[model samples]
Target: MPHSIPLIRAAAITPIRRWVEERGEDVGPFLARADLSWVPADDPALPVPLRSVVRLLVEISRAAGPDTPHRIVNGRGGFEIGLIGRAAFRGPTVRDGFARIARMMPAHCTHEIFTVALSGDGLHIRDGWAYDLGDDEALYLVQQYVASLIDMICSVAHPEAPRAERVEMVPHPEAGLNHLRPWLGDRLQPAPLRALDFLVGSDVAAQRFPKGAQERAREANGETGRRIASGASLADQVSALVAVMLPRTTPHLDRVAAAAGISGRTLRRALRQNGTSFSDVVERTRAQIAVDRVRNDTDVSLGSIAADLGYANQATLSRAVRRWTGQTPRSLRSGLKSRIEPGKPVSETRLSK
Candidate 1:
């Protein structure tokens, strides 16, 4: 069952409208288009179909300016945070690279929570949140858009280098992983569950972007401005965190409420009054993840994957999977094959600094 729409926000309206206008065929399911009555493009509230917009911006930024080797952040106010990484942390050290990422891209860059990790194999970045509660289309667009941005970064950073690295996210179920593998070739992860593995050498990891890039990426308004204009209400907070963080971790009542900076009791009462429950919402999300995982990857070993989820063993994981899909992992992956989509260059869009 689909989650019913909540009270739409004035802030989210413009992005919703732009999404419907530009790529609704691809981005329609999860996002609700904005009501024109709320705001027009003339208004600061006018949002673009941002996932698409950001992807396009990253693509342009990859090709923009001189080949000075800079990092681009998907900053707010209609533009990318171009090359602030090089300026922010000036060194060819993993610490500098990470500091650059931390300074520039906090979780919720463009309204989503993203985490970056350094695994032994590569730089593993995970993006998903139970917040940003639009619709499935908005979620899908955001996911795909992030993946493309990752791809653009790798292309510009490594160029034709074979052993450099690649970036990707866990994609939608219907579209398979073959496409990413083709573009990234040996660099791509073997599974849809592949995290953003930027396999770089110690030297590249230490290398920082150009000078002055960090300050340029810095937004003028501070976190206070973000809070004031955020348009998040007490109630919307619960759903928002659920939308973003839920994808990263299992959505427990306490966890969801905590993300909203609210009490679990208050969250339960709110959801109850609103005709839903935390458990119901979590189960729904889990169901979606289960189906997507099952339908998309034949190679994602269920037994070993039990650990990917917070399961002690396959039995615990299998129980939940069966409840959602009415099929065991063996049955689910039996006839499964992956999917792919044609790669297209996103349009050029530049924002004022």
Candidate 2:
């Protein structure tokens, strides 16, 4: 019999698998229970029933505590490493990015529809699901989707990242409230799940990407536009230096600036001209290096890999790997290909110190 339930892309739940493994538990039992054991680890775009995925998340949450959903979606990379994020970041502004994501999201998951609106000088985002999965499953799914959406918006905005002034979420237990308070803070209010909502300021949301088109053209013409007549692109140069320095010490802005024979302020200005911040470059460098090492070097211990990548320990690197690839290091080393891609230079160049 053909089932009528909506389907979510299998890629959407890889993070859940990584989380289960990170806790030192086997994923076979969980996948077996969800009837998802047949889903190939290598195939990301395969479809699985949305109800099954939500139930799997709810099951994990029950086993791991309410924080599982938050941890899965609230990580640094969020959805930007995925397909929708690549298309969205290529947009002209933060608000445009949201629109692109809203339009393209259905191709990734059918259960939810994303809507973006302008309310005077602010932006309102709403996530409306096609069908209810009941309270427990709905709560976890809402957290996973909504948090990823907010993080995607903020990441595209970069340094001028807009703050979510008000957010309304489905009612939760007090323990769940505590887990969420750190991220949503005082802006959170209990509301029905008709639609999950968030509001962000217009100025940052409307900040134009002055260099987006030019940079994209340049990258297409050359190999990532690594060079110019005078020297390498400052951002590329800084990334190279950071990658080299990761194993030795923290690539602090001041230290990296000195290595590049420029003052910290001057280096910051150069990177800003290239449409990135010091922290952003460092983050990209770390993600690229981490993915390369994990995918290519199966014999390397994760602890060693973490130390080489400047992470404090294996567990920290594991979380970062999960965020970047939606899979754990072991999973990646064992043959799961990373689905992350580097986003375009979409951040607006800011002059303010």
Candidate 3:
């Protein structure tokens, strides 16, 4: 069987609790419902189920009303930047910090993937889901996440640093614009994708953190990363590696083992210890990448997706889709397309089984 996706660190919810209470709303019941037991001050590092975090946000929004999402997210700024934030702040330069955060996001929040890329005149930071947040909640969640990122960037950035030139999101109603204005200002614009652009100067990117702060932060982050990796079984690591490799080439045990810095025999021994095989990891990785691409990228055709996954043809992909999802490739594609329609409920799009 494929390994279960990792849970998100509890620190992700710290800001929510803080903002909710600041609004004078009782958060105890909701936290209990979400099964969260600690506050931001507690500095809890325990991982919580991603569904529970989503549920907590949904429940908080319901209780606090529709504007709560914007209010809470904006009010807290980047106070709840989580583990990724901590590690990033410890880096020597702003660019280095942002890069580190992007790399560490997968270990912290496996439900979404983030990328920082350089555009012609500026840097474009894009975010896409590894799992669906559904349509009803997607906008608010996306806003909250993107806003938090903007806040983090602004906090450490020099006064002369690159300003956020543009902020884009899936089209949303005009009502929420008020809450976003303080952070995003006039830069907010509607786009087909979710991304933020920063016009950073070389000096800004090179600005160093305070003396010894970067080193201490890096050490702490390294320890945290190690702990996170140490918790995963060897099979889980191989599966993650295979997932990343599938888009570029067919992942083999030897390559995977080399990537893991182990001999093939040792890799086999590790997997056997974990009660799995190399082939099992490959299938699970392919199955995961297939579903993710299908659900997230509507413009990409089935044949193209199959080719990316190293499938000989779309027919093989269709068969594999049927086996994995109990639905044909066309049907799966249709469901994904339908979910992307504006105002449609997104409860049906599930990545975790």
Candidate 4:
């Protein structure tokens, strides 16, 4: 399953910059490394973007903690940086530090971080870091970070797990260069996307978290998420839920519940416990998603966009847009677009005929 798509991808990158500053490093080292073979940020040959891959490596490194090497790339536009750091270790039974990386990862990375959650009792992680790194040093740093995260996850796992979960490097044909079967008896997959997969027992995970910690974990770094959502404001809960499921038509409560694995009643109860109602949720989400999407994606045509949002006609869509966001569709588009393109009228609809 796709692990929290937005969080994983949205990690804060400041730590990477801080890490780089500490090392007195330059992008040159990555270019000089002989062992590193990288595809460019613009490489069309691969399915994933180099910058994104680099971004993941950096998040894992920072989450691993301090005193580790770091690497970064400066693409002309929208490029990313990387860093490597030490892993956190706690508890004797959880001997593998790598497993802890997997466990704690949700706390450190963003919602959009590249992650493929394997379904199993225990997790085995393999990893890959992408770069247009023309140098071996940068690539090596990426490799070490990947290896360290795997090590962290494995160390935290229960000593004897019944089944294993395979995680491999995204860029590898058979996981990563460390393809050899481990003597330690890990069940590793030599597949690309599984490189970061870990062998973790869900039962153990249940026991590891503190009371209410998982929910807290979910809220961590999630600045946009609501705190205790239900009764406070139906509009707010609906807004938050829609934010979580935008661009995908119909933010059905049941679907949200399924994504969260909670029953509709229970989900409603939790929302109520916090402060809101289900009807409020539906309205808030629909309104917010509509406004956000219309303002955010310029490429989508107005009519198609309206239809995707379940509006019967452009006029109804326009009215609803006005209700949610005190502005007409044209005004909304222009205002939002102006932030990205300076001086150009932000809204596409020219007000004067």
RMSD of every prediction = 22.2, 21.7, 18.7, 16.8
Candidate 2 matches the true fold with a TM-score of 0.54
lDDT of 1 by residue, 1-353 (tens): 21221222233333333433453333332232211221233333222223333333223323332111112222222223223223133323333544444444421133444465665535555665534433432344345444444433433333344424654444434443454454456565533443333445444454444334334345333121122122243334444434433333444565445433457887777777766566555444444555566666667866655564445677776776665556776766775432211111112111110
Kindly provide the TM-score of model 1 when superposed on the true structure, using C-alpha atoms. Answer: 0.39
Sum up the clashes in candidate 1: 28
Give the TM-scores of the predictions, in the order they appear.
0.39, 0.54, 0.54, 0.34
C-alpha lDDT of all candidate models, in order: 0.41, 0.63, 0.60, 0.40
Better of 2 and 3 by lDDT: 2
**Model 1 regions more than 4 Å off:** 1-100, 103-111, 120-122, 131-141, 151-168, 190-203, 218-353
Q: Write the per-residue lDDT of candidate 3 for residues 112-201, one digit (tens) a residue.
A: 666776665345666666544546354555555555555445455454422566666654343455455665677766655543334444
lDDT tens digits, residue span 59-127, model 4: 344444222421232111111211111222232223233344444443333221323343454433444
For lDDT, the strongest prediction is 2
Distance (Å) between predicted and true CA of 306, model 3?
49
